[model samples]
Target: MARYLLKRLALMVPTLLGILLLSFAVIQFVPGGPVEQLVYQLKGRGSGGEAAGGGSSGALYQGNKGLDPERLAQIRKDYGFDQPAPQRFWLMLKRYARFDLGESYYHHQSVTSLIVSKLPVSISLGVWTFLLTYLVAVPLGVAKAVRHGSRFDAVSTLILMLGYAIPGFVLGVVLLVLFGGGSFWQLFPLRGLTSDGWAQLSMLGKVTDYLWHLVLPVTAMVAGSFATVTVLTKNSMLEEIRKQYVLTARAKGLSETRIRYRHIFRNALIPLLTGFPEAFIGAFFTGSLLIETLFSLDGLGLLSYESVIRRDYPVVLGALFLFSIIGLVTKLLSDLCYALADPRLRFEGAPA
Candidate 1:
């Protein structure tokens, strides 16, 4: 197992490099990026601060027309844009060897600091969503499976299907309208991680305030992400319960309760357990995006979206690399779960 893990960890270096190279090639070669925007801003500022006339196009033209070759070259040199793409990539990798992620283009903050400052918020949101998803879905799925063909099962199936089909962004909007401050019940806070005067609150008060603000965003995330998992667990359980092992247990005079819960459910858990890592990754990365954006949660997804629009390459690439590493690590976790779920299966060097 140690050797297997070492091998997987070794493989991650190349995979991580591939991610960096791909992101670098796209962002570096792409036109109309941060450099161009900076040029336009500088150009507009060079005139009377109104970019030849007023709008963006006028500013871009004036900026381009006004800049001398020396100034252009200087600008490129200042941002390291003058270097070839390969050289820049090499420099970034070398910086990482010293544990630096460089600085954000616009913010002038270290990319590592930016991500670290925001990590707690993102992790809090992610952890809550991950816990709620598995805790609620597994039991609900089991019940639905056990009550299959009944009205409860049919109604739940329909509801879960509706949830699965609705886009998360659309669901977020609906949630905000109905539960947030809008035409309906203003039961939950509209946006943000805390209320005003949060810093002055007592410990319990602070905790309460924090949870109060989390209500809308977390609800949106859980509602958006749970349906598919629930349906999957239900289907897997139902399939397993009908298999010959279950029938054999029944024929052996085992009680129906023990046969279902002890034998059938235990085996049924294998498939779902294997998917745990994927579910966690989705909950943290993709699932959080639309929800956080809609509800104004200051999570990594929101930061990533903002950085992309602002063309903060350092932050963008930093976030990308971090997420890639997380995905690779989660895949390793899934492999571990696989061995735990089915003891017969083992890694190449795992002890018997």
Candidate 2:
């Protein structure tokens, strides 16, 4: 297992390098990059003022317009705009190697610092949603499978299918309208992850304050996601239950509970292991982009969204790079879980 894991880890370097190279190539080749915007700044022309770095940059550009060609060359060289793609990419990789992700073009903050600052809120919301999803889905699925073809199963199927049909963002909008300061219940805060003056609150008060804020967004997130897991769980459990071992256990006078849980659910859990990484990843630390935007939660997803809109390339690249690393690591972790769950997935020397 250790040797197999080390091999995979070694392979990740080139894989991640490929991903980064592709991303950098696309961003670099795309029109209207940071350097081109600086051109607008230099010309003192407002080709959309925001892209030109606004009034101060325009003034700075105007001041430098009368400078000698040598100064202009120096400026371009300083920013690496004069370099070819290969050199630029190599430089970027070198910077990343030293953990210097560069400063945000617009925010003027270190990219690492910016991402770190926003990561916690997304993680907090994600973890709560993850826990909620598994807590609700797994049990409901088991019950549904156990009572297959009964009224309870029928009702759950209908509800979950309905949820599956409705996209998460659409459901979020509906929920916001019905319960978020609309003509309906007006039961929850319209946006944000905390109330005013929450920082000044006592510990328990702070907990309640955050939970109160969490209710609606968490509701939207869970309601949108839990249905799929419930279905997966139910199907896996049902398949395991119908296997010959389950029948043999029942014939051997094992209680229904023992056969269902010990034999069936245990095996059923193996298939579901594949989903754990995706489930946790999509909710626990880095998903719910639309939902976060709707609620005005300051998270990495929303930051990436705004950065893209504003053409804040450093922030965009930094956020993407961070998520890319996390995704690859999580995929590796999922493979590890697969081997742990099913002995058939051996890492030792084999026929393969």
Candidate 3:
């Protein structure tokens, strides 16, 4: 097992490098540079002033009249923007090798620090949303499978279809209208992490307030996840129910519940387990985007969106790198899960 795990871990290096290369190449080829974005922002702040540093803007001429060209050239050199693309790529690799992810031009912060600050909020949201989704989905799926084409199954199928069909942002909007703008507006807070007086409250009160603020965003996130999980669960269970082992259990006069839960459910869970890692990685990265934006939660997704709009390449690349690492690790974990769940999946010559 250790040897197999080591092999898998070793394979991940090349996969990660490929992902990094692709991401870097795409970013490098994309039009617009960090300098342009900075200039645009500065110009905007200057109230529709001419482009800074040059172009048709008279502002550049006025601003640079007293500044030395040599000093400006030194400034650009210090920032490494004077280097050719190949040199920059080499420097990026060297920095990555040393675990130095560089700095964000827009935020004037280390890439690591910016991601670290925002990650907790995204993680907190992902955890609660995933928990809610599985808590409702798994049992409901089992019940539906057991009932087959009955009313309970029919109703669940309808709800699952509707949930899957509706985009999270659309659901968020509908929820905001019903619970945040209409008659029930005061029932749930529209946005943010906590209420105004939350910090002044008792510990339990603070926890309750935080949970209250989480309701809408969590609900929006769970809707689609729950629908997908339910469909997968129901299908897996349905297949397991028809297997020969289940027939054998029934022939032995075992209780229906015992055969279903003990045998079928356990087998069904293996397939579900295979999905957990990918599902979690997806939820961690993509799920929070729409939900966070709609609810105004400041997380990695919102941060990435703002960075993209402003052409903040450092933040965009940093976030993509983080997500890529996560995806690779998640896939590795899924492979480990597969080996654990099925003896047949054990690596050739692997230790027992």
Candidate 4:
């Protein structure tokens, strides 16, 4: 197992390199990059008033035209564009090796600092989504399985299917329209994780306000997520109930509840466990963009999107690096979960 783990970890180096290299290449090739933006800055005609370097607006120029060739060359050299792409990539790799993600071009802040500031919102959303999903899904699925073809199962299936069909952002908009201050019921806050007066609120008030703002966003996030787990649980339980082992347990005069909970439950959990790593990491990393934007939450997902739009390469690349590492590690953790849930399972080439 240790050898297998080491081998997998070793494989991540090349995988990570490939992902970063491809991303870097794309950024380099894309137009309207840092150099062009800087030319606009120096010309002082772009939408953004001034560039990061605070270059003076000397003349109105378009697309580097009418700009001094020397100044243009100097801008390229200063931004390290003078070097070949390979050399720049290598230098970036070295900095990343030291865990130095560098500074954001637009934000004028270190990449790590920006991520740190934004992480709490994502973590909050992710945790709530994860907990709500599993806590509700697993039990709901088991109930549906046990009572298959009953009114309860039919109703829940219909509800879950409707939720699955609706996109999260769309649900968010609907939620806001119905519950936000502007509309029908006005049951929830429209944006942000807390009220402006959060710091001044009492302990209980703070908690209430936090959860109050979380309602729409969390609901939107988990709206479509429940079906997969719930359905998986129901189907797995149904399949387990029919297995010979379950029948054997019943023959031994075990109660129905004991048979279901003890023997069938453990086996049914294996397939569900396969989804754990993905759901876990996804809660933290993926699918935050539209939700965050719609609800006005500042999270890593929103930050990443902003970085791309503004061509903030440092933050963009840094976020990708961080997310990739987390994803690879989570996959390994999922394999561990599989081994734990079913000892019969083993990493390939490991001793039986």
TM-score of each: 0.89, 0.88, 0.88, 0.93
Q: How displaced is residue 155 in candidate 3, in Å?
A: 1.1
| Candidate 2 Cα deviation (angstroms), residue 282 | 3.7
Number of clashing pairs per prediction, in order: 1, 1, 0, 0
lDDT score of residue 56 within candidate 1: 41
- TM-score of predicted model 1? 0.89
lDDT for model 1 comes to 0.79
Q: Tens digits of per-residue lDDT for model 1 on 1-352?
A: 7889999999999999988898888875444555566786775554222222344445345567868878877877877888888899999989876768889987789998988877767877887888988899888898999999999999988887787777767877887899887788988888778888999999999999898887777766777567867887788889998899988888899998898789878888988888789777766565477777787767777788778766678899887877788899999999899889888886895566
Q: How accurate locally is residue 325 in candidate 2, as Cα lDDT from 0 to 100?
A: 77
Regions more than 4 Å wrong, model 3: 41-75, 349-352
True-vs-predicted CA distance for residue 30, candidate 1, Å: 0.9
- Shift of residue 334 alpha carbon in model 2, Å: 1.2
**Per-prediction CA RMSD (Å):** 3.8, 4.0, 3.8, 3.7
Lowest lDDT sum, 10 consecutive residues, model 4, at: 52-61
Candidate 4 contains a number of clashing pairs equal to 0
Give me the runs in candidate 1 sitting further than 4 Å from their true place: 45-62, 285-287, 349-352
Ranking by lDDT: 4, 1, 2, 3
Cα-based lDDT at residue 252, candidate 1: 92
What is candidate 2's TM-score against the reference? 0.88
Better of 2 and 4 by TM-score: 4
